[model samples]
Target chain A: MIKARITVTLKNGVLDPQGKAIEHALSGMGFDGVGQVRQGKVFDVELSESDKAKAEADLKAMCDRLLANTVIENYSVAIT
Target chain B: MKSAVVLLPGLNRDRDMIAALTKISGTPPLTVWQTDTEIPDVDLITIPGGFSFGDYLRCGAIAARMPVMRAVAEKAAKGVMVIGVCNGFQILVEAGLLPGALMRNTSLKFVCRQVKLQIANANTMFTRRYQPGQIIRSPVAHHDGNYFADAETLRRLEGEGQVVFRYAEGTNPNGSINDIAGIINGQGNVLGLMPHPENLIEAAHGGSDGRALFESALGIAA
Candidate 1:
């Protein structure tokens, strides 16, 4: 089995209210050096396919079709 | 005109949509489940507002992939009028039936209230009952009502007159670009909006400004 980790994050220039709230909370708790906190989603999947290359391609297709909203987000997949 | 409502799991406002359509069209709308793969013949299909799939991943992301939506898309492509309210609007966007994406409100809070909306275009099948530039009141309830699109897409939507509604009097509830409250597809057959016209269909609901939308779509003049 091949395991893949997919991370999805909003593209730059898109406003992220939840991330901004987190950043504010961190500052309120005395983490003054924190400049920004952009939120993202992570999905870990185990593919039954043994070939790493094929698993990676399938994961990419999944991300494009369902896992990520390409209009405002970017996704990256890592296979292990 | 015959109408139907698509019922996705976790949908809360399907009943409201049914009631509104039944009262207006004089016939009950057929409810199609999310798992269903075929859609019955209907002139109009409405996607009601609700937290489908518990709003996981994204508000309408999961619902957009449901089997029923495939049928909905097919009918819509053939010129069937489709109206998506709140979560339904999000689903249409996630399904790629409409442009732009809905994000969390800029205030980082769930906003639920009646807001004024200016009809940007009253010539579409869904807005013909209203006069051009008419301002109507409707209830908008959602956390992710803010609409975002690329600059080029925004310009194109404006140029094509696809912007159907705009928040009135600078009351931008969610910081949506150009204060857009609703939009129609290129063929003017699909409309997606954050406001719930289903919640405002009768005088008991404070006003009937939303009724004209249904009446217009069904070709029934008020």
Candidate 2:
């Protein structure tokens, strides 16, 4: 059995109001030297396939199909 | 006119949509559940507003994968009319049936109120009853109605006249680019909008501005 991790985040130019709010809250709580905080989602998926190459491709397809909205978000998959 | 409304789990506005379509089309629209894989023969398919799947994993992410949506997308490709309102609009965007994404309102507040909309294009079947540039009032209630799109897509929409509705008179309730209130697919058969036209179709609701939308959609108006 193999496991994969996928991280989805808003693209560089996309506006992230929620992340901005979190950044403001952290600064209010006196966390200095923190320049920016962009929020993202992470998913840990278990694969039944043992072939690392096929599993990596499948995870990418999963991200492209549903795990991320390519218009505003980007995702990266890593097999562990 | 034959029509159907797709019902997803947590869809709170199905009844309102049914009532509106029934009153306008003179026929109660067929209600198709999300589990259904096929949609009955109908001229129009409406995906109504409400918090589908409790708005989890992005507003319409979960509901967009329902079997009924597959049928809806297929029918839309064949030129059947599809109207997606509020959360429905979000679903269409997430399902890749429409361009852009509905982000959280810039203010990060749930805005619920009537807003003036300008008819951007009245040549299509969905907006035929309204004069171009006419101002109409409709209620918008959503926290994630802010529309976001890349500059190229926005330009393409504007150039193609796919932008069907614009929030009027600089009354930009959300941070939607170009103050877009609604848009149509390239084929002009699918429409996704943030406002609740179903709620404003009766005089008892204080305005019939939304009635023309139904009338145009049902092909009963000049």
TM-score of chain B alone in model 2: 0.98
TM-score of each model's chain B: 0.99, 0.98
lDDT of 1 by residue, B1-222 (tens): 899999988989999999999999899999899989999999999999999999999999999999999999999999999999999999999999999999999998899999999999998999999989999999999999999999999998999989999999867789898999999999999999999988898989998889999999999968
Mind giving the per-residue lDDT tens digits that candidate 1 earns over A1-80?
89989999999999998999999999999987999899999999998999888898999999999999999999999985
Tell me the spans in candidate 1 whose CA falls farther than 4 Å from its real position.
none
How high a TM-score does candidate 1 get? 0.98
Q: For every model shown, what is its TM-score relative to the native structure?
A: 0.98, 0.97
Best by DockQ: 1
Q: What's model 1's lDDT at A77?
A: 99
Report fnat in order of the candidates: 0.94, 0.59
lDDT of 2 by residue, B49-135 (tens): 999999988899989998889999999999999999999999999999999999989888899999999999998889999999999
Docking class of 1: high
How do the residues A1-80 of candidate 2 rate in per-residue lDDT, one tens digit apiece? 99999999999999998899999999999999778899999999999999999999999998888889899999999888
